[model samples]
Every structure is written in structure tokens, then in C-alpha cells.
Target: MYQVYYTRDKAGRITQKLETIEGITHSIDYSYDLAGRLIEVKQDGTVTETYQYDANGNRLNNAQYSKCTTK
Candidate 1:
């Protein structure tokens, strides 16, 4: 089994997530614009994803996700 922990802002936006698997844990931090639109994700303190949107709330482009490394 796995475990997931989340931190949400008062605006009901998930600001962070910590997931555990096989007793190992990894965390991702979320960022948003003032309007609460998702903008970026930092996995283990390095950005691994990005997002963009249009004024009409349509996704302008595909988000990027890649393996995160710790050095």
C-alpha cells in the first residue's frame, strides 16, 4: 500500500503533496497564480513540470513532466 499526504490552501488548492511507496517517500510542491491556476511543480525541490492556460481557462499547451534528480 501507498500513502499520500497533501497540503491545501484556504482557497482549496493543493499546494503540496508527499507520497510514500514501499516506505520511501517523495514530495512535490505546487505553485499557482493569484487566480489559482496551476503554474509549476517542483519535485524534490527542482521543477519538473510546467503549465500554461488561456484566458478562457483552456489549456494553451501541454504540460511537461520529467524525471527529477537529486544531486
Candidate 2:
């Protein structure tokens, strides 16, 4: 079996996750807006996905990026 670890924010949100197998490790990170909404996702320290929300707490759109792009 592999091992997985997680880091969380003060509000108990999952901020990062790491998994290791066969001496290789992979990591994913998450970011949240002030309202505790998911705003971004990163892999290996590079932004890979993003989310936008309207004022009503609804998801506006989701975007996936090739390489690291900032918006």
C-alpha cells in the first residue's frame, strides 16, 4: 500500500496532499477565497486549475491550464 498525507488550514480545509509510492512522491495543493470557497488548484507547485464564483456562492466557471498560467 502507498502512503498519503494531508495538510489543512485553520478552518479544516485541505490545503495540500502528498502521496508516495515506490520512492516517488506527488503533491497537490488547494487555495481558498476568503469565504472558504475553492479558488485554485496546483500540482507540483504549479497552478493547474482555477475556479470562479459569483456573489451567490455558485460556481461561475472552471478552467484548466497547460503549464503554469495566472489569471
Candidate 3:
């Protein structure tokens, strides 16, 4: 399980996030344009993912990955 906390700026722009689970912690940072368009998202001390959008606010691209392994 994972829990997340969100922090926003006065403009209501989400600037940071903290995620924790099972004693491990991960942080995420966000940046938005003046138009409030999300331009970037960074996690776990790395720029592991990115997002892009079209003029109509439709998601054009997103890059991320996840996997589960059991031994």
C-alpha cells in the first residue's frame, strides 16, 4: 500500500508530493506553466517520467512504468 500527501501553491498549483509505504519514502515534484498546464513530473530523485498534452487539454503522451515480481 502507498499513501500520498499533496502540497499546493497559493495559485492552487500542485508543487510537491510525498509518498510513503512500508517504511520507504518517495517524493515527487511538479511544475506547471502559467496556463496551469502540467509540463513535468519527477519522482524518487529522478526525472523518470514526463507528460505532454495537446491544445485541447488531451493527453498526447505519458512515460512511466511499473512491474511486480515474486520469488
Candidate 4:
């Protein structure tokens, strides 16, 4: 069986998600901008991925985001 848990900040934004399966625990942490847009994803306190957007909130291409694990 698997279990999941979530944590939220006072501003009501999701801050973390944790999942447990077969005695192994995995987690993902979240960050947001003042506008509440998701900005970064981390594991074990290391940033592994990021997101980009135009000023109007349109998703932007991240050709410069070298940290992305998948192309």
C-alpha cells in the first residue's frame, strides 16, 4: 500500500507532498511566487527542476533551465 501526505502554508499554498510505499519514503517540496505560481521543485532540499512564465502567466519555454532532468 501507499500513503500520501501534504503540507500547506498559511497563505494556503501547497508546500510539500510526501509519499510512502513499501517502507520507502519519497517527498517533493514546492515553492511559489507572490502571484502564487509554482516556481521550483526540490527533493532532499536540492532543486532539481524549475518553471518559467511570462509576466501574464503564460508558460514559457525553459531552454536555459539546465537543471531539468528530462528534455
Best-fitting candidate, scored by lDDT: 2
Clashes of each: 0, 0, 0, 0
The 10 consecutive residues of candidate 1 with the worst lDDT sum are 60-69
- Candidate 4 per-residue lDDT, tens place, 14-68, comes to 8998989998888889989888888888875677678889979986854222344
Write the residue-wise lDDT of candidate 1 on 1-71 in tens digits: 69999999999899999999999988999999877888899988888888899898776875777774599
Q: Quote each prediction's TM-score.
A: 0.80, 0.86, 0.65, 0.74
Off by over 4 Å in 4: 62-71
**Ranking of all predicted structures according to lDDT, beginning with the best and ending with the worst:** 2, 1, 4, 3
TM-score of 2: 0.86
lDDT of 1 at 71: 100
- Pick by TM-score: 1 or 3, better one: 1
- Tens-place lDDT per residue, model 3, 1-71, is 78889999999888899989987888899988767877778777667567788878877998774433499
What digit string (tens of lDDT, one per residue) describes model 2 on residues 1-71? Answer: 59999999999999999989887898999999999999999988889999999989999999998984499
* Model 1 error, position 23 (Å): 1.5
Worst 10 residues of 3 by lDDT: 60-69
Q: For all the candidates, what are their Cα RMSDs to the real structure? A: 2.4, 4.6, 3.8, 4.5
- Clashing residue pairs for model 3: none
2 versus 3: better TM-score goes to: 2
